[model samples]
Target: MSISSAAPPKPTQVLPYATKDLHEVYTLGTKLGQGQFATTYLCTHNTTGETYACKSIPKNKLLFKEDYDCVWREIRIMQHLSELPKIVKFHDAYEDSFFVHLVMELCEGGELFDRIVQKGYYSEQEAVKLVKNIVEAVQDCHSLGVMHRDLKPENLVFDTVEDDADLKIVDFGLSVFYKPGEIFSDVVGSPYYVAPEVLNKHYGPEADLWSVGVISYIILSGVPPFWADTEKGIFAQISHGILDFQSEPWPVISDSAKDLIRKMLDRNPGKRFTAHQVLSHPWIVDDNIAPNKPLGV
Candidate 1:
Protein backbone atom coordinates (compact mmCIF):
# COMPACT_ATOMS: atom_id res chain seq x y z
CA MET A 1 0.00 0.00 0.00
CA SER A 2 3.05 2.26 0.14
CA ILE A 3 3.12 4.90 -2.58
CA SER A 4 6.18 4.78 -4.82
CA SER A 5 7.11 8.32 -5.84
CA ALA A 6 9.79 7.18 -8.25
CA ALA A 7 7.60 4.82 -10.25
CA PRO A 8 6.32 6.19 -13.54
CA PRO A 9 3.02 8.09 -13.38
CA LYS A 10 1.36 5.50 -15.57
CA PRO A 11 2.36 2.14 -17.00
CA THR A 12 2.76 1.75 -20.75
CA GLN A 13 2.61 -1.90 -21.75
CA VAL A 14 -0.77 -3.58 -21.94
CA LEU A 15 -0.59 -5.98 -18.97
CA PRO A 16 0.23 -9.26 -20.74
CA TYR A 17 -2.94 -10.97 -21.98
CA ALA A 18 -3.04 -14.75 -22.14
CA THR A 19 -5.88 -16.44 -23.93
CA LYS A 20 -4.80 -20.01 -23.29
CA ASP A 21 -4.98 -19.54 -19.55
CA LEU A 22 -8.73 -19.07 -19.97
CA HIS A 23 -9.97 -22.42 -21.15
CA GLU A 24 -11.71 -22.35 -24.51
CA VAL A 25 -15.23 -23.72 -25.20
CA TYR A 26 -16.53 -21.86 -22.17
CA THR A 27 -20.07 -20.84 -22.83
CA LEU A 28 -21.04 -17.19 -22.32
CA GLY A 29 -24.18 -17.26 -20.23
CA THR A 30 -26.62 -14.42 -19.60
CA LYS A 31 -25.43 -10.83 -19.34
CA LEU A 32 -24.12 -9.69 -15.97
CA GLY A 33 -23.69 -5.94 -16.56
CA GLN A 34 -22.98 -3.42 -19.29
CA GLY A 35 -21.38 0.03 -19.62
CA GLN A 36 -20.40 2.35 -22.41
CA PHE A 37 -17.05 0.64 -22.97
CA ALA A 38 -17.56 -2.95 -21.87
CA THR A 39 -20.09 -5.76 -21.71
CA THR A 40 -19.97 -8.40 -18.98
CA TYR A 41 -20.95 -12.05 -19.31
CA LEU A 42 -21.32 -14.88 -16.84
CA CYS A 43 -18.93 -17.65 -17.88
CA THR A 44 -17.85 -20.87 -16.28
CA HIS A 45 -14.25 -22.02 -16.11
CA ASN A 46 -14.16 -24.85 -18.63
CA THR A 47 -12.02 -27.14 -16.51
CA THR A 48 -12.74 -26.17 -12.91
CA GLY A 49 -16.47 -25.72 -13.41
CA GLU A 50 -16.15 -22.42 -11.57
CA THR A 51 -18.17 -19.33 -12.50
CA TYR A 52 -16.76 -15.87 -13.24
CA ALA A 53 -17.85 -12.49 -14.57
CA CYS A 54 -16.03 -11.89 -17.83
CA LYS A 55 -15.90 -8.27 -18.94
CA SER A 56 -15.12 -7.57 -22.58
CA ILE A 57 -13.75 -4.08 -23.40
CA PRO A 58 -13.76 -3.49 -27.12
CA LYS A 59 -10.55 -1.93 -28.41
CA ASN A 60 -12.48 0.16 -30.93
CA LYS A 61 -14.45 1.85 -28.16
CA LEU A 62 -11.19 2.54 -26.38
CA LEU A 63 -10.99 6.06 -27.83
CA PHE A 64 -7.28 6.12 -27.16
CA LYS A 65 -4.88 3.31 -26.54
CA GLU A 66 -4.64 4.85 -23.06
CA ASP A 67 -8.04 3.34 -22.30
CA TYR A 68 -6.46 -0.05 -22.93
CA ASP A 69 -3.57 1.06 -20.76
CA CYS A 70 -6.02 2.02 -18.01
CA VAL A 71 -7.30 -1.54 -18.15
CA TRP A 72 -3.73 -2.62 -17.38
CA ARG A 73 -3.61 -0.22 -14.46
CA GLU A 74 -6.85 -1.68 -13.22
CA ILE A 75 -5.30 -5.13 -13.52
CA ARG A 76 -2.18 -4.08 -11.67
CA ILE A 77 -4.23 -2.36 -8.96
CA MET A 78 -6.47 -5.39 -8.53
CA GLN A 79 -3.55 -7.82 -8.61
CA HIS A 80 -1.56 -5.95 -5.98
CA LEU A 81 -4.38 -6.01 -3.43
CA SER A 82 -4.06 -9.81 -3.09
CA GLU A 83 -7.56 -10.42 -1.75
CA LEU A 84 -9.55 -7.60 -0.16
CA PRO A 85 -12.80 -9.30 0.82
CA LYS A 86 -14.79 -6.12 0.19
CA ILE A 87 -13.22 -5.38 -3.15
CA VAL A 88 -14.02 -7.38 -6.26
CA LYS A 89 -11.31 -9.89 -7.16
CA PHE A 90 -9.61 -9.63 -10.54
CA HIS A 91 -8.63 -13.07 -11.84
CA ASP A 92 -7.07 -12.57 -15.30
CA ALA A 93 -6.91 -10.56 -18.51
CA TYR A 94 -6.58 -11.68 -22.11
CA GLU A 95 -7.12 -10.41 -25.61
CA ASP A 96 -9.32 -11.41 -28.50
CA SER A 97 -9.39 -9.69 -31.92
CA PHE A 98 -12.27 -7.44 -30.96
CA PHE A 99 -11.61 -6.78 -27.29
CA VAL A 100 -9.70 -7.39 -24.08
CA HIS A 101 -11.33 -9.94 -21.80
CA LEU A 102 -11.11 -9.43 -18.04
CA VAL A 103 -12.06 -12.34 -15.80
CA MET A 104 -13.36 -11.21 -12.42
CA GLU A 105 -15.30 -12.56 -9.43
CA LEU A 106 -18.89 -13.28 -10.36
CA CYS A 107 -21.26 -11.44 -7.99
CA GLU A 108 -24.85 -12.49 -8.66
CA GLY A 109 -26.33 -9.89 -6.32
CA GLY A 110 -28.06 -7.16 -8.28
CA GLU A 111 -27.18 -3.46 -8.17
CA LEU A 112 -27.65 -1.66 -4.84
CA PHE A 113 -29.62 0.99 -6.74
CA ASP A 114 -32.43 -1.43 -7.64
CA ARG A 115 -32.72 -2.43 -4.02
CA ILE A 116 -32.90 1.22 -2.89
CA VAL A 117 -35.75 2.00 -5.31
CA GLN A 118 -37.59 -1.19 -4.41
CA LYS A 119 -37.53 -0.41 -0.71
CA GLY A 120 -38.13 3.35 -1.15
CA TYR A 121 -35.55 4.05 1.52
CA TYR A 122 -33.29 2.05 3.79
CA SER A 123 -33.86 1.85 7.51
CA GLU A 124 -31.32 3.85 9.54
CA GLN A 125 -29.76 0.69 10.89
CA GLU A 126 -29.50 -0.88 7.46
CA ALA A 127 -28.01 2.32 6.01
CA VAL A 128 -25.42 2.39 8.76
CA LYS A 129 -24.34 -1.16 7.97
CA LEU A 130 -23.99 -0.64 4.21
CA VAL A 131 -22.17 2.69 4.60
CA LYS A 132 -19.67 1.30 7.11
CA ASN A 133 -18.71 -1.56 4.84
CA ILE A 134 -18.42 0.79 1.87
CA VAL A 135 -16.25 3.22 3.81
CA GLU A 136 -13.98 0.39 4.86
CA ALA A 137 -13.59 -0.67 1.25
CA VAL A 138 -12.82 2.90 0.18
CA GLN A 139 -10.23 3.15 2.92
CA ASP A 140 -8.57 0.07 1.46
CA CYS A 141 -8.54 1.65 -2.00
CA HIS A 142 -6.96 4.86 -0.66
CA SER A 143 -4.26 2.92 1.14
CA LEU A 144 -3.37 1.47 -2.25
CA GLY A 145 -3.37 4.91 -3.94
CA VAL A 146 -6.23 3.86 -6.19
CA MET A 147 -9.11 6.34 -6.45
CA HIS A 148 -12.45 5.07 -7.74
CA ARG A 149 -13.74 8.09 -9.71
CA ASP A 150 -17.23 6.65 -9.99
CA LEU A 151 -18.65 5.26 -6.71
CA LYS A 152 -22.41 5.21 -7.13
CA PRO A 153 -24.49 2.48 -5.46
CA GLU A 154 -24.80 0.82 -8.87
CA ASN A 155 -21.10 -0.03 -8.64
CA LEU A 156 -21.57 -1.70 -5.22
CA VAL A 157 -22.80 -5.32 -5.41
CA PHE A 158 -23.88 -7.69 -2.66
CA ASP A 159 -22.89 -11.34 -3.02
CA THR A 160 -26.19 -12.45 -1.45
CA VAL A 161 -28.04 -12.08 1.83
CA GLU A 162 -28.21 -8.77 3.67
CA ASP A 163 -26.49 -9.35 6.99
CA ASP A 164 -22.74 -10.06 7.05
CA ALA A 165 -22.69 -10.16 3.24
CA ASP A 166 -19.71 -9.22 1.13
CA LEU A 167 -20.31 -5.95 -0.74
CA LYS A 168 -17.92 -5.90 -3.68
CA ILE A 169 -16.76 -2.62 -5.24
CA VAL A 170 -16.86 -3.26 -8.97
CA ASP A 171 -15.97 -1.28 -12.14
CA PHE A 172 -12.57 0.41 -12.26
CA GLY A 173 -12.81 1.92 -15.72
CA LEU A 174 -12.46 5.44 -14.31
CA SER A 175 -10.05 4.51 -11.52
CA VAL A 176 -6.59 6.07 -11.23
CA PHE A 177 -3.57 5.99 -8.96
CA TYR A 178 -2.10 9.15 -7.46
CA LYS A 179 1.22 9.46 -5.73
CA PRO A 180 1.88 12.26 -3.25
CA GLY A 181 1.57 15.70 -4.86
CA GLU A 182 0.16 14.17 -8.03
CA ILE A 183 -2.80 16.23 -9.23
CA PHE A 184 -5.31 14.66 -11.64
CA SER A 185 -7.39 16.66 -14.09
CA ASP A 186 -10.23 14.64 -15.54
CA VAL A 187 -13.89 15.71 -15.49
CA VAL A 188 -15.42 12.28 -15.35
CA GLY A 189 -18.08 10.46 -13.27
CA SER A 190 -21.88 10.45 -13.16
CA PRO A 191 -23.43 13.91 -13.04
CA TYR A 192 -25.31 13.38 -9.78
CA TYR A 193 -22.27 12.10 -7.89
CA VAL A 194 -19.49 14.23 -9.43
CA ALA A 195 -17.84 16.83 -7.22
CA PRO A 196 -17.98 20.52 -8.05
CA GLU A 197 -14.23 20.67 -8.58
CA VAL A 198 -14.54 17.82 -11.05
CA LEU A 199 -16.92 19.88 -13.21
CA ASN A 200 -14.24 22.59 -13.19
CA LYS A 201 -11.56 20.08 -14.31
CA HIS A 202 -9.79 19.90 -10.94
CA TYR A 203 -10.12 16.98 -8.60
CA GLY A 204 -8.51 14.28 -6.48
CA PRO A 205 -9.60 11.38 -4.27
CA GLU A 206 -11.89 13.70 -2.29
CA ALA A 207 -14.10 13.77 -5.37
CA ASP A 208 -14.97 10.18 -4.67
CA LEU A 209 -16.07 11.21 -1.19
CA TRP A 210 -18.51 13.60 -2.82
CA SER A 211 -20.03 10.67 -4.68
CA VAL A 212 -20.29 8.84 -1.40
CA GLY A 213 -22.30 11.74 0.03
CA VAL A 214 -24.72 11.61 -2.85
CA ILE A 215 -25.10 7.90 -2.27
CA SER A 216 -25.73 8.39 1.45
CA TYR A 217 -28.50 10.83 0.62
CA ILE A 218 -30.04 8.33 -1.77
CA ILE A 219 -29.93 5.64 0.87
CA LEU A 220 -31.62 7.91 3.41
CA SER A 221 -34.19 9.19 0.95
CA GLY A 222 -35.36 7.50 -2.22
CA VAL A 223 -33.79 10.11 -4.50
CA PRO A 224 -30.51 11.91 -5.06
CA PRO A 225 -29.88 15.16 -3.20
CA PHE A 226 -29.36 17.10 -6.38
CA TRP A 227 -31.97 16.69 -9.13
CA ALA A 228 -32.26 18.90 -12.17
CA ASP A 229 -34.70 19.44 -14.99
CA THR A 230 -31.83 19.09 -17.43
CA GLU A 231 -28.18 18.14 -17.53
CA LYS A 232 -27.24 21.83 -17.39
CA GLY A 233 -29.46 22.36 -14.39
CA ILE A 234 -27.93 19.42 -12.61
CA PHE A 235 -24.42 20.61 -13.40
CA ALA A 236 -25.27 24.10 -12.17
CA GLN A 237 -26.67 22.77 -8.92
CA ILE A 238 -23.57 20.69 -8.33
CA SER A 239 -21.27 23.48 -9.41
CA HIS A 240 -23.02 26.03 -7.22
CA GLY A 241 -23.05 23.69 -4.23
CA ILE A 242 -26.82 23.64 -3.88
CA LEU A 243 -27.39 20.41 -2.01
CA ASP A 244 -30.32 20.83 0.39
CA PHE A 245 -31.94 18.20 2.57
CA GLN A 246 -35.62 17.66 1.89
CA SER A 247 -37.16 17.91 5.36
CA GLU A 248 -40.29 15.89 4.58
CA PRO A 249 -38.84 12.91 2.73
CA TRP A 250 -35.76 12.69 4.92
CA PRO A 251 -35.87 9.55 7.04
CA VAL A 252 -35.45 9.63 10.79
CA ILE A 253 -31.73 9.82 10.24
CA SER A 254 -29.36 10.91 12.99
CA ASP A 255 -28.02 14.45 13.09
CA SER A 256 -24.51 13.07 12.97
CA ALA A 257 -25.35 11.34 9.72
CA LYS A 258 -26.50 14.59 8.14
CA ASP A 259 -23.35 16.34 9.35
CA LEU A 260 -21.18 13.60 7.89
CA ILE A 261 -22.89 14.02 4.54
CA ARG A 262 -22.28 17.76 4.69
CA LYS A 263 -18.65 17.20 5.51
CA MET A 264 -18.20 14.81 2.60
CA LEU A 265 -20.03 17.06 0.14
CA ASP A 266 -18.03 20.11 1.14
CA ARG A 267 -17.22 22.17 -1.94
CA ASN A 268 -13.65 22.77 -0.93
CA PRO A 269 -11.58 19.62 -1.12
CA GLY A 270 -9.37 21.01 1.66
CA LYS A 271 -12.34 21.04 4.02
CA ARG A 272 -13.64 17.59 3.12
CA PHE A 273 -12.78 14.68 5.38
CA THR A 274 -10.67 11.79 4.09
CA ALA A 275 -12.08 8.27 3.91
CA HIS A 276 -10.16 7.27 7.03
CA GLN A 277 -11.43 10.29 8.97
CA VAL A 278 -14.99 9.73 7.81
CA LEU A 279 -14.74 6.12 8.91
CA SER A 280 -13.88 7.22 12.45
CA HIS A 281 -16.73 9.72 12.83
CA PRO A 282 -18.97 9.21 15.86
CA TRP A 283 -21.94 8.63 13.62
CA ILE A 284 -20.11 5.68 12.10
CA VAL A 285 -18.25 4.47 15.17
CA ASP A 286 -20.19 5.15 18.39
CA ASP A 287 -23.88 5.08 17.43
CA ASN A 288 -23.51 2.07 15.16
CA ILE A 289 -20.86 -0.52 15.97
CA ALA A 290 -22.36 -3.78 14.93
CA PRO A 291 -19.74 -6.44 14.14
CA ASN A 292 -19.99 -5.64 10.41
CA LYS A 293 -22.76 -3.08 10.35
CA PRO A 294 -22.83 -0.60 7.52
CA LEU A 295 -21.40 2.75 8.67
CA GLY A 296 -24.78 4.58 8.60
CA VAL A 297 -23.74 7.98 9.88
Candidate 2:
Protein backbone atom coordinates (compact mmCIF):
# COMPACT_ATOMS: atom_id res chain seq x y z
CA MET A 1 0.00 0.00 0.00
CA SER A 2 1.19 3.51 -0.76
CA ILE A 3 0.99 6.49 1.53
CA SER A 4 -2.30 8.35 1.46
CA SER A 5 -2.49 12.10 0.99
CA ALA A 6 -5.78 12.63 2.78
CA ALA A 7 -5.34 14.22 6.20
CA PRO A 8 -7.77 14.72 9.09
CA PRO A 9 -9.36 18.05 9.91
CA LYS A 10 -7.82 18.50 13.36
CA PRO A 11 -5.70 16.52 15.75
CA THR A 12 -8.44 16.28 18.44
CA GLN A 13 -11.89 17.64 19.40
CA VAL A 14 -14.01 18.58 22.47
CA LEU A 15 -17.70 17.85 22.95
CA PRO A 16 -20.40 19.17 25.26
CA TYR A 17 -21.62 17.09 28.20
CA ALA A 18 -25.22 16.03 27.49
CA THR A 19 -26.12 14.12 30.63
CA LYS A 20 -29.37 15.26 32.28
CA ASP A 21 -28.05 15.93 35.78
CA LEU A 22 -25.04 18.25 35.68
CA HIS A 23 -22.74 15.95 37.63
CA GLU A 24 -19.04 16.67 38.39
CA VAL A 25 -17.98 13.77 36.17
CA TYR A 26 -18.87 15.70 33.03
CA THR A 27 -17.78 19.34 33.24
CA LEU A 28 -16.33 20.12 29.85
CA GLY A 29 -13.69 22.73 29.29
CA THR A 30 -11.35 24.19 26.65
CA LYS A 31 -10.07 22.18 23.71
CA LEU A 32 -6.77 20.48 24.36
CA GLY A 33 -6.03 19.11 20.90
CA GLN A 34 -7.87 18.36 17.69
CA GLY A 35 -7.20 15.86 14.93
CA GLN A 36 -8.93 14.98 11.69
CA PHE A 37 -10.96 12.23 13.37
CA ALA A 38 -11.32 13.50 16.98
CA THR A 39 -10.89 16.31 19.50
CA THR A 40 -9.73 16.31 23.13
CA TYR A 41 -10.71 18.61 25.98
CA LEU A 42 -9.73 19.22 29.56
CA CYS A 43 -12.71 18.46 31.75
CA THR A 44 -13.47 18.50 35.47
CA HIS A 45 -15.35 15.70 37.16
CA ASN A 46 -18.29 17.15 39.09
CA THR A 47 -18.08 15.25 42.38
CA THR A 48 -14.30 15.01 42.75
CA GLY A 49 -13.36 18.27 41.04
CA GLU A 50 -10.55 16.23 39.51
CA THR A 51 -9.64 17.13 35.94
CA TYR A 52 -9.47 14.73 33.00
CA ALA A 53 -8.86 14.81 29.28
CA CYS A 54 -11.82 13.83 27.16
CA LYS A 55 -11.20 12.88 23.55
CA SER A 56 -14.47 13.14 21.65
CA ILE A 57 -14.70 11.65 18.19
CA PRO A 58 -17.81 11.39 16.08
CA LYS A 59 -19.69 8.10 16.47
CA ASN A 60 -19.59 7.75 12.72
CA LYS A 61 -15.82 7.51 12.89
CA LEU A 62 -16.09 4.15 14.61
CA LEU A 63 -19.00 2.60 12.70
CA PHE A 64 -17.01 2.04 9.54
CA LYS A 65 -17.60 4.08 6.38
CA GLU A 66 -15.49 6.77 7.99
CA ASP A 67 -12.51 8.10 6.08
CA TYR A 68 -10.07 6.24 8.32
CA ASP A 69 -10.51 3.30 10.67
CA CYS A 70 -7.69 4.58 12.89
CA VAL A 71 -9.94 6.15 15.54
CA TRP A 72 -11.85 2.96 16.23
CA ARG A 73 -8.69 0.90 16.11
CA GLU A 74 -7.13 3.18 18.72
CA ILE A 75 -10.05 2.80 21.09
CA ARG A 76 -9.78 -0.97 20.90
CA ILE A 77 -6.05 -1.01 21.57
CA MET A 78 -6.31 1.51 24.41
CA GLN A 79 -9.08 -0.50 26.03
CA HIS A 80 -6.86 -3.57 25.84
CA LEU A 81 -3.76 -1.94 27.39
CA SER A 82 -5.65 0.33 29.80
CA GLU A 83 -3.81 -1.09 32.80
CA LEU A 84 -0.35 0.11 31.79
CA PRO A 85 1.00 3.05 33.84
CA LYS A 86 2.92 5.15 31.32
CA ILE A 87 0.30 4.56 28.65
CA VAL A 88 -2.50 7.09 28.70
CA LYS A 89 -5.11 6.15 31.28
CA PHE A 90 -8.52 5.45 29.75
CA HIS A 91 -11.36 6.71 31.94
CA ASP A 92 -14.59 6.11 30.00
CA ALA A 93 -15.87 5.77 26.44
CA TYR A 94 -19.45 6.34 25.38
CA GLU A 95 -21.32 7.10 22.19
CA ASP A 96 -24.63 8.80 21.52
CA SER A 97 -25.10 8.80 17.75
CA PHE A 98 -23.49 12.23 17.37
CA PHE A 99 -20.22 11.62 19.11
CA VAL A 100 -18.06 9.21 21.12
CA HIS A 101 -16.29 10.49 24.20
CA LEU A 102 -13.13 8.80 25.42
CA VAL A 103 -12.24 10.05 28.88
CA MET A 104 -8.57 9.70 29.74
CA GLU A 105 -6.23 10.83 32.51
CA LEU A 106 -5.18 14.47 32.33
CA CYS A 107 -1.50 15.26 32.02
CA GLU A 108 -0.35 18.83 32.39
CA GLY A 109 2.81 20.52 31.04
CA GLY A 110 1.90 19.59 27.47
CA GLU A 111 4.00 17.46 25.10
CA LEU A 112 7.73 16.83 24.95
CA PHE A 113 7.65 18.46 21.52
CA ASP A 114 6.81 21.74 23.20
CA ARG A 115 9.74 21.33 25.54
CA ILE A 116 12.03 20.46 22.65
CA VAL A 117 10.92 23.52 20.76
CA GLN A 118 11.51 25.63 23.84
CA LYS A 119 14.93 24.16 24.66
CA GLY A 120 16.03 23.38 21.09
CA TYR A 121 17.47 19.94 21.86
CA TYR A 122 18.55 18.06 24.96
CA SER A 123 21.96 17.11 26.35
CA GLU A 124 23.21 13.54 26.16
CA GLN A 125 22.56 12.86 29.82
CA GLU A 126 19.11 14.44 29.62
CA ALA A 127 18.29 12.50 26.48
CA VAL A 128 19.30 9.27 28.17
CA LYS A 129 17.04 9.87 31.17
CA LEU A 130 14.01 10.70 29.09
CA VAL A 131 14.67 7.81 26.71
CA LYS A 132 15.04 5.47 29.67
CA ASN A 133 11.63 6.37 31.03
CA ILE A 134 10.09 6.09 27.58
CA VAL A 135 11.72 2.73 27.00
CA GLU A 136 10.27 1.48 30.27
CA ALA A 137 6.84 2.69 29.20
CA VAL A 138 7.11 1.08 25.75
CA GLN A 139 8.32 -2.08 27.41
CA ASP A 140 5.17 -2.02 29.50
CA CYS A 141 3.07 -1.62 26.38
CA HIS A 142 4.88 -4.45 24.58
CA SER A 143 4.39 -6.69 27.58
CA LEU A 144 0.67 -6.14 27.18
CA GLY A 145 0.81 -6.82 23.41
CA VAL A 146 0.33 -3.15 22.50
CA MET A 147 2.44 -1.40 19.91
CA HIS A 148 2.14 2.36 19.54
CA ARG A 149 2.19 2.87 15.77
CA ASP A 150 2.89 6.54 16.34
CA LEU A 151 5.64 7.26 18.82
CA LYS A 152 6.94 10.78 18.50
CA PRO A 153 7.98 13.58 20.80
CA GLU A 154 4.52 15.12 20.52
CA ASN A 155 2.86 11.92 21.80
CA LEU A 156 4.80 12.14 25.07
CA VAL A 157 3.10 14.27 27.69
CA PHE A 158 4.67 15.52 30.89
CA ASP A 159 2.86 15.15 34.18
CA THR A 160 4.33 18.16 35.91
CA VAL A 161 4.36 18.14 39.69
CA GLU A 162 6.29 20.23 42.20
CA ASP A 163 9.48 18.17 42.38
CA ASP A 164 8.86 15.01 40.43
CA ALA A 165 7.76 15.26 36.81
CA ASP A 166 6.45 12.12 35.14
CA LEU A 167 6.49 11.30 31.43
CA LYS A 168 3.30 9.74 30.11
CA ILE A 169 2.73 8.44 26.60
CA VAL A 170 -0.54 9.53 24.99
CA ASP A 171 -2.22 9.63 21.56
CA PHE A 172 -3.09 5.99 20.95
CA GLY A 173 -5.13 6.83 17.88
CA LEU A 174 -2.62 4.92 15.74
CA SER A 175 -1.85 2.06 18.10
CA VAL A 176 -2.78 -1.57 17.59
CA PHE A 177 -2.84 -4.77 19.60
CA TYR A 178 -0.68 -7.61 18.29
CA LYS A 179 -0.16 -11.30 18.95
CA PRO A 180 3.04 -13.16 18.35
CA GLY A 181 3.61 -14.06 14.65
CA GLU A 182 1.20 -11.36 13.54
CA ILE A 183 2.34 -9.31 10.56
CA PHE A 184 0.92 -5.78 10.21
CA SER A 185 0.82 -4.29 6.73
CA ASP A 186 -0.63 -0.87 7.39
CA VAL A 187 1.59 1.93 6.05
CA VAL A 188 0.98 4.43 8.81
CA GLY A 189 2.84 6.86 11.07
CA SER A 190 4.50 10.25 10.56
CA PRO A 191 6.69 10.37 7.50
CA TYR A 192 9.65 11.60 9.48
CA TYR A 193 9.47 8.79 12.02
CA VAL A 194 8.13 5.85 10.01
CA ALA A 195 10.24 2.73 9.70
CA PRO A 196 11.64 1.64 6.34
CA GLU A 197 9.59 -1.56 6.38
CA VAL A 198 6.44 0.45 6.92
CA LEU A 199 7.14 2.37 3.73
CA ASN A 200 7.40 -1.00 1.97
CA LYS A 201 4.05 -2.10 3.45
CA HIS A 202 5.61 -4.72 5.74
CA TYR A 203 5.66 -3.61 9.34
CA GLY A 204 5.34 -4.82 12.90
CA PRO A 205 6.39 -3.70 16.38
CA GLU A 206 9.77 -2.82 14.96
CA ALA A 207 8.07 0.05 13.17
CA ASP A 208 7.35 1.55 16.54
CA LEU A 209 11.01 1.19 17.45
CA TRP A 210 11.92 3.03 14.26
CA SER A 211 9.81 5.90 15.50
CA VAL A 212 11.61 5.67 18.81
CA GLY A 213 14.85 6.03 16.91
CA VAL A 214 13.58 9.21 15.30
CA ILE A 215 12.58 10.60 18.67
CA SER A 216 15.97 9.64 20.08
CA TYR A 217 17.71 11.39 17.24
CA ILE A 218 15.61 14.46 17.82
CA ILE A 219 16.42 14.33 21.51
CA LEU A 220 20.12 14.57 20.71
CA SER A 221 20.34 16.34 17.35
CA GLY A 222 17.43 18.76 17.74
CA VAL A 223 16.28 17.72 14.25
CA PRO A 224 15.12 14.70 12.29
CA PRO A 225 17.70 12.73 10.33
CA PHE A 226 15.58 11.78 7.32
CA TRP A 227 14.16 15.16 6.33
CA ALA A 228 13.27 15.63 2.66
CA ASP A 229 12.23 18.37 0.27
CA THR A 230 8.88 16.86 -0.56
CA GLU A 231 6.39 14.27 0.71
CA LYS A 232 7.24 11.85 -2.08
CA GLY A 233 10.91 12.40 -1.46
CA ILE A 234 10.39 11.74 2.25
CA PHE A 235 8.75 8.37 1.62
CA ALA A 236 11.35 7.55 -0.99
CA GLN A 237 14.15 8.28 1.46
CA ILE A 238 12.49 6.23 4.16
CA SER A 239 11.86 3.40 1.70
CA HIS A 240 15.43 3.35 0.48
CA GLY A 241 16.83 3.32 4.05
CA ILE A 242 18.77 6.54 3.63
CA LEU A 243 19.44 8.47 6.84
CA ASP A 244 21.06 11.88 6.43
CA PHE A 245 23.18 11.98 9.53
CA GLN A 246 26.20 13.59 7.92
CA SER A 247 24.19 16.57 6.74
CA GLU A 248 25.63 19.69 8.24
CA PRO A 249 24.84 21.66 11.44
CA TRP A 250 25.20 18.56 13.58
CA PRO A 251 25.46 18.73 17.35
CA VAL A 252 28.17 17.50 19.66
CA ILE A 253 26.74 14.03 20.19
CA SER A 254 28.31 10.93 21.70
CA ASP A 255 29.01 7.66 19.94
CA SER A 256 26.55 5.81 22.15
CA ALA A 257 23.73 8.09 21.12
CA LYS A 258 24.58 7.63 17.46
CA ASP A 259 24.90 3.91 17.95
CA LEU A 260 21.43 3.71 19.45
CA ILE A 261 19.98 5.53 16.46
CA ARG A 262 21.80 3.30 14.02
CA LYS A 263 20.50 0.20 15.72
CA MET A 264 16.91 1.38 15.93
CA LEU A 265 16.91 2.76 12.39
CA ASP A 266 18.19 -0.44 10.86
CA ARG A 267 16.16 -1.07 7.68
CA ASN A 268 15.74 -4.77 8.34
CA PRO A 269 13.21 -5.37 11.10
CA GLY A 270 15.07 -8.50 12.10
CA LYS A 271 18.14 -6.42 12.88
CA ARG A 272 16.47 -3.53 14.67
CA PHE A 273 16.91 -3.67 18.41
CA THR A 274 13.83 -4.43 20.44
CA ALA A 275 12.68 -1.85 22.97
CA HIS A 276 13.93 -4.13 25.78
CA GLN A 277 17.26 -4.48 24.05
CA VAL A 278 17.56 -0.72 23.73
CA LEU A 279 16.81 -0.42 27.45
CA SER A 280 19.65 -2.80 28.29
CA HIS A 281 22.17 -1.16 25.96
CA PRO A 282 25.29 0.25 27.56
CA TRP A 283 24.26 3.83 26.83
CA ILE A 284 21.22 3.40 29.04
CA VAL A 285 23.13 1.34 31.63
CA ASP A 286 26.29 3.35 32.15
CA ASP A 287 27.22 4.41 35.68
CA ASN A 288 26.20 7.98 34.84
CA ILE A 289 22.57 7.02 34.58
CA ALA A 290 20.23 9.05 36.75
CA PRO A 291 16.51 8.35 36.98
CA ASN A 292 15.00 11.82 37.38
CA LYS A 293 17.56 14.11 35.87
CA PRO A 294 15.76 16.31 33.42
CA LEU A 295 16.92 16.03 29.81
CA GLY A 296 19.76 18.52 29.16
CA VAL A 297 19.66 19.53 32.80
Candidate 1 stretches greater than 4 Å from native: 1-18, 21-25, 118-121, 288-297
Could you tell me the C-alpha RMSD of candidate 2 in Å? 6.5
Worst 10 residues of 2 by lDDT: 13-22
Score each candidate by Cα lDDT.
0.77, 0.75
lDDT of 2 at 192: 89
Clash tally, candidates in order:
9, 20
Task: Give RMSD to native, each candidate.
Answer: 6.8, 6.5
- Model 2 agreement with the true structure over 1-297: per-residue lDDT tens digits: 899886455423222334432233588899999987788888888878889999887655653333334665677777777777777888776655466678888888678868657665345677787788888888888888888888888789887632246788998877888887688887778878888888787777888888888888777666787778898888777777456556432334556767888898888899999988998898898956333333343
Query: Residues 150-256, candidate 1, lDDT per residue (tens digit)?
Result: 99988999876554567779988788888755678878888888888888887788888888888887876666888788888888888774666656444445677
Q: List TM-scores for all candidates, in order.
A: 0.87, 0.83
Best by lDDT: 1
Model 1 gets an lDDT of 0.77
